[model samples]
Target: MKKVLIISSTRNSNLDLSKDIKNYLMDKDELETEVIALEDFELPLYTPTLEEQFKSTESFPKNISKIKDLICSSDVMIWCSPEYNGGISPIVTNTIAWISRATDDWKEGFKDKHCLICTSSGGNGKNFIKGFEMQLKYLGSNVFDRSLIKTKAKNIEEFEFTSVLTDFYKNIFSE
Candidate 1:
């Protein structure tokens, strides 16, 4: 069975959208899926001082290591995040920063992993998509070019995105 991790960065109604996507992904019998919310991971703001301190401690916070291990173990990743201030949310970036530092090879958590990005945002969320894709590519992840976007006016079911998501997953797993 393929292990898939779905990460959601939103804390509001957008979280419902993430759950919906998770349900859809779980419907696939061959995939074992786990959903993680960024809010649940209490990552402190990253700074050079903290980085040095953490290195000296020689042990990362348990949540950081746990999330890093999940990323490392997953075959594919699906991200559902909201755009904030015309960019990716700070929570998402913070999680990435911590996970990158927690592991010896920063890219080890993402390299060669198939990724699918989706969003439910008040705004169009195009900037979030572009910004995250750039980061994922830099991390050497195989991010899908297509994505699902649901604006405030549409609900997940109304958006009718399951087919695209299914196809994306099928294509990636077939590789």
Candidate 2:
């Protein structure tokens, strides 16, 4: 079975969106899915000095290790996050920073992984999509060409949301 990890960057609307997406993904019997809220994890701010300290520490933090393991093992990741001031949320960025520093391969968790970006934002969310796409691509992930955007006046249609996921799933299996 394929291990699919669905991550939400916040506990608010983003989490709701993640859960909704998880349900749609679960409808695929062949996939093994797990959902996580980024706020639930204990992650420290990442820096070169922090990385040095962690590398020299006697033991790695359990929470970071656990989260890293999840990311490493997953075949696909669906990132559901909010856009904050025309960019990706800080929580998601923090998670990525910590994971990159903690992992031996640095980009192992994202390299070649299929990532589907979804957003529940108050704004247009186009900037978040563009920003995250660049970041994910830099991390070596195969980001989905299109993203699902949900906002105040407009919400993603059921068919459109599921169709995005369906196409992403097919893309993964095709590779």
Candidate 3:
């Protein structure tokens, strides 16, 4: 079975949303799913100085190293975050920063992988999806076009959720 890593970028609605996604994917027999909430990790801000320090120590922070292992082992990645300041939240970006820098084993960890971007934010979450989709594609991920987005007044309709997940699942497994 292929492994899928679902990342929740915040402890707020995004976490709840990620859990929902995990529950949905867990039922699939062809795939195994795991959820990681950023709130559960003890990660420091990534910086050039931090990278140098980690290089000297020959190790990343415990949680970041663990996350790196998960990301490298997984066959697919699902990101659930809020739109912060018309872009992705700092937690998501920071986690990616750490993952990208804190590794030599999987330097291009995301290359040719499949990524699905979803958001449960107060706003429409369009900017986040757009920005994150571009970033993931730049990392060589094949991103799904149909995203799951939830606004204050509008929860994801069943049809939209079903359609997106169905297409996303097909896309990941077919690749």
Candidate 4:
């Protein structure tokens, strides 16, 4: 079975959203799903000084390397994040920054891999979703167009979001 890694880039209530996505994906027998909360991998803020240190040492921080490996190993990636200040949360960007620097071939970790971006936020999640897709595509991921968004009004009921996510997975698997 293909392995799918779902990355939740928020803490607290957003964790519930990520769990919902995991449970929905689990319903499918075709793919084995794992959920990784960004909070679990607490990385230091990236800096040029740190980059120089890692390069000179010829090794990345253990957590950063581990996350890069996880991203490379997975067949597909699902990102559930929140919008902060009209953009992706810092945690999400931080992880990406670390992963991009940790490897010789940054794009290799992401290139052509199936990717889906979703968000649960105060308002409609369009800004985060759109911003994230731009970055993901730039990194060479084959991003899916239909993204799942849960706004304050809807807030992602279990059944509706799950059904949409399941259908999205089915379509991706079919293709």
Error of 1 at 5 (Å): 0.6
Q: Candidate 1, after superposition: displacement of residue 14 in Å? A: 3.0
- Ranking by lDDT, best first? 2, 3, 1, 4
Per-model TM-score on C-alpha atoms: 0.93, 0.94, 0.94, 0.91
Which tens-of-lDDT digit does each residue in 1-175 have in candidate 1?
7888888886665667667777877778778888888898888898879889878987657888888899899988989899899999999899899888888899999999899888989877999999999999999999998888888886556445877787787777677
Native-referenced Cα lDDT, model 4: 0.84
RMSD of each: 1.6, 1.4, 1.4, 1.7
Residue 5, model 2, lDDT? 95
lDDT of 2 by residue, 1-175 (tens): 8999999998888889988888887879679999999889867776778767877885567888889999999999999888899998888898888888777788999999999999999976999999999999999999999898899789998889878888888988986
What's the CA error at residue 133 for candidate 3, in Å? 0.6
Please write out the lDDT profile of model 3 over residues 38-141, one tens digit for every residue. 87896898899988988898876788888888888888989999899999888888888988886773346788888899999888999999999999998788
Which ten contiguous residues of candidate 2 have the minimum total lDDT? 51-60
| C-alpha lDDT (0 to 100) for residue 75 of candidate 3 | 88
Clashes of each: 0, 0, 0, 0
The residue-level lDDT of candidate 2 at 127 comes to 92
CA RMSD (A), model 3: 1.4
Off by over 4 Å in 3: 105-107
